[model samples]
Target: MKTTTAFPQASRSRSGWLIAISLLLLLAMALISLGVGPVSIPLETVWQWVLQRESQESLSEFTILSSLRLPRVVASLWIGAALATAGVGFQCLFRNPLADPYVIGASSGAALGVATSVVVGGTWSVAGFNPTSMFAMMGAIATVGLVFVIGSSRRGTSSLTLLLAGVAVSSLANALVSLLMFVHDGQKTMVILNWLLGSLASSNWQTLPAVLVLSTAGMFWLWMMARQLDAYSLGDIASQSLGLDLFRLRLSVVLAASLATAAAVSTAGVIGFVGLIAPQIARLLVGTRHTLLIPMSALLGASITLIADAAARTVVAPAELPVGILTAMLGCPFFLGLLLRRPRTYSRPGRRGG
Candidate 1:
């Protein structure tokens, strides 16, 4: 006798309320982020600045609004959105909530690429490209490709196998990075350390286009795969039974997600936890439905990063903390709490629909 439990009506209603509340919270956080910084701006001034409304505001105020704060805020928004959307896609692909965008070794690959560009590329210049960004993208793609090849068996890819391969690749990349650091002098060491720490200090309008392109494409691609992702949550056999082409679906997701991640990391370095935490928060608000979860997660992720960036700038006054450090500091405890919550177990074979 096969049985299945549908969500209760009350549960559905509660989910709706949670989603609404989450959206409100995101908007509030964004506004708060724009207002708080090393030099605080009045809410009215921020509003005017955002709307391009000129006021009798001082030069310092204009500098803070236009030159310093605006680019960083925008970077936080897009970067966070990219990571969160990618996280959702990755978690769905692996069928593991603990899985993150970095699980496929993209982060390590990006790091290696950055290291190579800094160490080998004289002056870190290449005709038109920023060598660091270019190398990071290349490393990310190569890492994904390697993981795919290593994880595939005669039957096709196995989640367990793919995860293990990623772990191996990540370890190798980390070792290489460490070795490079060990051999470098003080100046080189400082450059590598700062890059690894992750900062939004370098953001500008010039970097926005690439981030927008990658993020928009990735989000659209993931949304298109919403049904397939839902099917996968039911298990491999269930997805196959539903006419989903597992290999093709997985490839598309990985490609889209990896590209988005690579673009973001190339510009911002590794900003951890946006992908992992954003989706979980979205799920808590919107249940397991991918359609709502994906976009909402993107928004929430942006809000979280923007808020964290604001805190980083304000906490030290003229000195700044790495945005990545702030994210991990917040995300780690939340992750531990989730682990201790003891999630429900679904029987393997019983994953098929009623």
Candidate 2:
């Protein structure tokens, strides 16, 4: 994790205009997703439906779209955005381009927590927050904290240590999840397995608001720290000299990332790759400043998930694939391609000017 190679410099995000275009693309993708479901609705009809002025068409499609697809799509959007934003924070905190929300085992820990909750068979709520989410968040925080502790036990936590610790923790969490599934009944086993695989199937109006609150709060916190994150990219000492409380900033960023990630997993059961890939795509377009990277990542993440969800339902028709599966299919190759090409370029990190 120690090195002399300088971090790659990106053009600073000088204007917000490009980000505006990303928002527009997100809107277009949402509409397209609405029309591309199992029961396809015409683009014109969907457009009218969205506009809310009465159309001379049947209401069944609208009902299906609203009651079912709407919440599902909204869940995907929230989870995607949250995860992608989390990824940005982690990348900066760890000073590693490949760092992601799951890189520190947050997703696996959240899944394990939910699986335990299901087996425990108690539906507790705190201030209207469901126990599932509460437990998931706790697990994610605990896991990330553990990884952080172990990774930093020897020295200032290096990216290699953090990543290695994360892999170990992730493996342990998945093992525990498997153990829980095996001890349970067939019905419970199926539920656990499905949740682990990830889907937006469980999302509904009842659960949407919780995710919204978490996403809003977490993203806001991260955005507010964007400048500190940019400073961290200049290396830890330089960031500290810039009046950043490096320890507190790193802790806050990690916690924020964990909170968003846990909420997404709680709502949609560990949808993968949105966190890992979206930020990279955003960086390519909007450069590396966290202010620009965060929003752009969120938009791209939401759009990718919507498109993936659309394909998930229609690809096998009646036998729908999990959205997580689709993400893996897409992400694995993209990730490997990143590794395969210019392998050393991204890992190099050092100080840079604001």
What's the residue-level lDDT of 105 in candidate 2? 93
Residue range 250-346, candidate 1, lDDT tens digits: 8888888887788778788889998999898788667787867787788888887888788888889779999999999988898678756734432
Give the distance in Å from residue 4's predicted Cα in candidate 2 to where it truly belongs.
31
- Assess each prediction's global lDDT (C-alpha) against the native: 0.81, 0.81
Q: Which 10-residue window of candidate 2 scores lowest in summed lDDT?
A: 1-10
lDDT at residue 323 of model 2 (Cα atoms): 92
> How many residue pairs clash in all the candidates, one count each?
0, 0
lDDT of 2 at 212: 86
Which candidate leads in TM-score? 1
Those runs of model 1 whose alpha carbons end farther than 4 Å from true positions after fitting are: 1-21, 122-129, 153-155, 342-354
TM-score of each: 0.89, 0.86
